[model samples]
Target: MSREKLLEVKNLKQYFKSGRHSVVKAVDGLTFDIYKGETFGLVGESGCGKSTTGRTIIRLYDATDGEVWFNGENVHAKKSRKELKKFNRKMQMIFQDPYASLNPRMTVKDIIAEGIDIHGLAKNDKERTERVHELLETVGLNKEHANRYPHEFSGGQRQRIGIARALAVEPEFIIADEPISALDVSIQAQVVNLLKKLQNDRGLTYLFIAHDLSMVKYISDRIGVMYFGKMVELADSDELYKNPIHPYTKSLLSAIPLPDPDYERNRKRVPYDPSMHDTSEEPEFREIKSGHWVLCTTKEFEQYKAEMENK
Candidate 1:
């Protein structure tokens, strides 16, 4: 792993036992690097384990195997309680549903101040209150709104409160797990813009998980495509859109809606034919380009290489 990388996840796997003899692979052997100040987008269909990967990395769900290196420290390795608490302050997550993530019973002030209090970020009640107000203001909410309950705010406003809570700890790394997906289409842009501004102003690193390729393209520096608990493709956002390598990636890009009605009507939808592919055996992630990587079995990898070469 490069020393410059802020987070280096290697062969990370998270699996859950289902029936007596079956297991559900949620995040299977995923590997990626997140730089200090870059937004890395993880995109996939629902239940593809994109969110699982984010949750596992933050230690909300312990990994079944592999390592997560944060600032040269292996975070997945068992740590003392103090170490764990310190680590928590450095990393935070913004959940998918803002309304569900916040406490309906707690006032916005208490919600934002929760992390600050836990991390001992403030010395006194006044300091904590000031910090809470500052975070609210940072995410474009007024200080006076701190006394209001989450149920009192609109969806967008509730999401802003969630963002404020995430920012309260002044984290260096954030996992924005589909932060705008639950909002109105019109509100999506506003939330996305707020996240972008926060990243720019705070120099924060992000693992942005979403299903919207268009929004991922807008906010991400690099994007990783996940399918069935594995990352099939990863590349620079523009490069991936322009020159998608994996068949799955190509299909996904083809599905992005075009602005022109004529073009939209002419474009074909990517057929979802699971029978055409086999994921019975897990694939190892390997680099196909300098910075791009994919997970494919040895036989499948050779076949894909041959096909790309022929093209």
Candidate 2:
């Protein structure tokens, strides 16, 4: 791992056993690096293990194999209880479902203050109350709103509360797991803008997991495309959008609706053929261009090279 890298995930795999003797590989030999202060977007279809990758990296789910290194230390290396607590303070996750993530029984104040209480962030009860109000204000909610329950707020407001809770621990890294998918389209931009502002203000690093290609392209520095359980392509946002290398990535880009009606009508949807795009044989992620890596066999890469040459 390099000194500049904040998080290094190498060959990470997460598998589950089902039936008599079958294994469902949710995350298969994935590798990537997140720098100190950048949003790395992970995009895929519903069951492609994008969320599993985020959870596994944060130690919410133990890896079946491979390493998740945070600041040059392997997070899965079995540390002491004290060390684990410290590790928890540095990393946090904001779940996809805002309605289910927050505790319905607890007041908004209690929910936001839970992490602060656990981490002993405040010296006394008065200090804790003040800190909770500060967190609420940071996410655009006022201090008076802290006494109310989550049900009182709308979907967008609830998601903001979840974001406030994640920020309570003063974490250096956050896994924003589909933060805006469930909200109304009108409000999605508001939440995304808030996240971008917060990232700039705090210099936070994020692993933003989502299926929205347009929003991902807007917020991410680099975008990674996944198929089945393997990473197919990774490159800078503009480069990937301008020149997608992998077939799976090309298909995903094609699906993003164009703003111009004439262009949308002229565009053809790319079909996903399982036979033509199979990863049964594990594909190795290799650097095909500067700062761009892809997973494919040598034969498949040659075919792509030939096609590009002809074009």
Candidate 3:
């Protein structure tokens, strides 16, 4: 399979100013890439800048430093409104909450058509209505429901509408910020399967951010584990699960519950203490193996490389 880079991020930083003296480094100099036609899952604990990273990538939040390149174009650099509008049509976001993300006052058709109108995808009113109806069916909703309000639908249906909205502009890349985290456990799988099917059919790339490791493993081709505003480990889903090298990555993996009752009972959770590592220097993200990447200090990087050599 070809591993063509669809999105490339280098030293991306998104920091929030708290006061004159304090600043919250939500995304502190992180870097990663999303391959074309691949879902790159980003899993991390709460308040670890996972969503912030997704927002930064989509240009929902302006970065304090670093660069984001999408298909060879630098997104963070200033562009004319026309250029920026063209960029917007190729990149879109699917927000986490189905309830809050959709406007309660707007009908489902109008909600989905917002992007279509902005991009002028449909030239006429009839065309716009037809496009919205088509999108509704594309996301598994009946065309009859296009005129209904968001409150009239279930959470899953609402999420499907959200997906349709994101798809309205025919975006090549999507940033799904914890797309299924707010959903019921039973509904999560349905949404994930829908996303996977859409990707297969549309050849869309995704930056799927979530806290659920098992779900991430199932849906993602590659996964990146983030902590405290930085990515610690990135590898193929199976490789990361089998050989998590960073202490933080190991801790996150150990928390995933197994399906087997016996294994679940015997599983031990690893606790991560960030203070144990030397935080004075900016660690380098290195490829210890052909595909596996990890962020580590000089000493730890040498140790990891040595261990990989032995293996």
Q: After superposition, how far is residue 224 of candidate 3 from its true place, in Å?
A: 1.0
Global Cα RMSD, each model? 2.4, 2.1, 1.5
Q: Is candidate 1 or candidate 3 better by lDDT?
A: 3
For each candidate in the order shown, give its overall lDDT on alpha carbons. 0.88, 0.90, 0.92
Query: Tens digit of lDDT per residue, candidate 2, span 195-296?
Result: 999999988898999999999999999999988888999998998898787988888989999789999989998877757844656566767778878777
Estimate the TM-score of every prediction: 0.93, 0.95, 0.96
**Who wins the TM-score comparison?**
3
Tens digits of per-residue lDDT, candidate 1, 158-245, equal: 9999888888888999999999999999999999999999888989999999999999999999999999898889988997887676
In candidate 2 the C-alpha lDDT for residue 167 amounts to: 93
Query: What's model 2's lDDT at 221?
Result: 92
List, in order, the clash count of every candidate structure: 0, 0, 0
- What is residue 159's positional error in candidate 1, in angstroms? 1.0
